[model samples]
Target: MMEAPCKRRRGDDDEDAGDRDRLNALPDSLLREVMSHMKARQVVQTCVLARRWRNLWRSMPCLDVDQDEFTTAGVSVVYSDHEGWERFEDFMDTLLCPGNVSIALLDTLRLHASSMGEDRRASRWIRRGIKYPHAGQEPGLQRGAPSCSSWRLRRLHLSNLYLCNLLAEHVRSRCPSLEDLELESCTCEFPAIASRSLKNLVLKRCALKGFREITSPPTEEPVYQWWL
Candidate 1:
């Protein structure tokens, strides 16, 4: 005798259901907090877990968008091929687009694209991170307007990207609330980086041939370790 095929238990089914729904039972604020610790792509991928998590990532306060996150499998292709750069740009655009992000709650935006020839795209993403709606209109109403009032953007970090003078100026003028800035292995042709609100600045292995002035009030001396 095969022991009557071992009847299924109702308690087992109940336990399974409870386990599946445990994450969904968490509050939205907690969920967003958890998403904030994750990479931008990992946060986006959580949408597939269930319908309740579909838009949870959009509410996250921090976005860490690095091309290296997507190049885990194809290092050489991502670093040397045009199509790889395009794919990275497209993925970043999808996350940084106004429609996909909750701009008012955003606190930090970090981008790392080691590939060359992506300066324009990097600048555009930086601009988007600093933009918000005007005062008298609904959110997302205005495009390319100063949004110091609506955003909480405090920390910005860029790595392995080229920064032009005009783009650097735009960053200084538009992101008035920026507190901490980090540039690593970047080529910046800007004459100056003057920010009234910036407190902490970090530059590592950066090319600053065009840099002439940094007008931030003296805080802790900026970390300026550059490798040739």
Candidate 2:
């Protein structure tokens, strides 16, 4: 009982082909580009796909976080179920925690904070995302340490969250490259809106109390629709 050499060779070749990892073979930049199109949750979940993908999401340039994703069949489980809210908060904490996301590479952050039923927690996460002296900065003032002004966040959209007065301060001092800002259905406590680099501002169905001025150079008068 002897096996044929040609058949054995063919079988070995098939196995070798199966062992090849085509997805991993692609360039990291290309893979990340493809990941940019997916939701932030899906991108983070890709870590379970393979070892190489585990840390790939840390450098993602864009993230879109929607609280609705935690819902089940058009009903928000986050507000109804305690465990669900905890899970959502945990996910947000992990995603925005220090040393988790490479802030240097982050370009855009879109947060849909509706249906969370936790305004304080959601507001904290927003602050973490746009804080000036972020956790990603170099530890001390070294010779060639990267400047704190290297923030690359260009566009920020906050939906259905409570924003404090410090938000304006953060935009003016911390985010040097922020150009577009949109706030929808948010209760803003800021007294004024001011930013040097901000070009486009949109406030939709947002509740503003004692909001007096807009310091930014006139830009279409800020598209305010359905102000609350």
Candidate 3:
């Protein structure tokens, strides 16, 4: 005689149904906000969850593309395998492409790589995304300053990188919406940085030799936090 069909557990069925229903009920904006806090890879993986999530990442307002995320699950960043580096590059190229993300609403971008400047591919990809439209010539970011800028960039955080002397000028002239700037363990060559829109400046363990001061709005001095 054939065995009776196994019955599904009521609790398990309800729990699964509730999860799907709750996720599906959330508005796109709220979902996108939730996605902002997740890793770039995880965010992209959500596309396979359902039809509604297929294109949500394309308009995500904030993106954190950290190279550390590409490493092996339990490996330290220092001993990361190079195998995932190429994948990381490919992911960045696809994500940064003009049609991939809504550049108009992109206000925050945090790129964390162990040696970003040394890796030409990483720099090129960054330039490509930062350029947004033009993709031919190598911009000044490689040489010194970033020639291309985004009008919507409000917060910029640089860590363990060499910043150029013209960075201040570029921000003042190009990045009109910039408000927060943070540099950690970075080598800055700029003597002074002045921006009418900058509201917060934080420097931690940065090497400041000739660097003199930061010029910001007089109504209220930009909150300055420095750690030697």
Best by lDDT: 2
Q: Kindly list the per-residue Cα lDDT of model 1 for residues 1-228, writing each as its tens digit.
A: 656778779899999899888877889888888888888888899989888888777667678887766564555665566666777788877775655774445678787886756665676665554454222223544333344544566887888877777556755666677788888888888898887678777888888976887877575454444455
Which 10 residues in a row give candidate 3 its minimum summed lDDT?
136-145
lDDT of each: 0.70, 0.72, 0.69
Specify the highest-TM-score model's number: 2
> Candidate 2, residue 78: CA error in Å?
6.3
lDDT of 2 by residue, 88-180 (tens): 778888876776674444678788875536765788875665553356433441223234545677888888888888788777777777788
Collision count for each candidate, in order: 0, 0, 0
RMSD of every candidate to native, in Å, equals 5.1, 6.6, 7.1
| lDDT for position 162 in model 3 | 63
User: For model 1, what is the C-alpha lDDT against the true structure?
Assistant: 0.70
User: Alpha-carbon error at 49 in model 2, in Å?
Assistant: 1.6
Q: Roughly what TM-score does model 1 have, to 2 decimal places? A: 0.76
Model 2, residue pairs in steric clash = none
Point out where model 2 deviates above 4 Å. 1-22, 72-78, 102-105, 130-146, 218-228
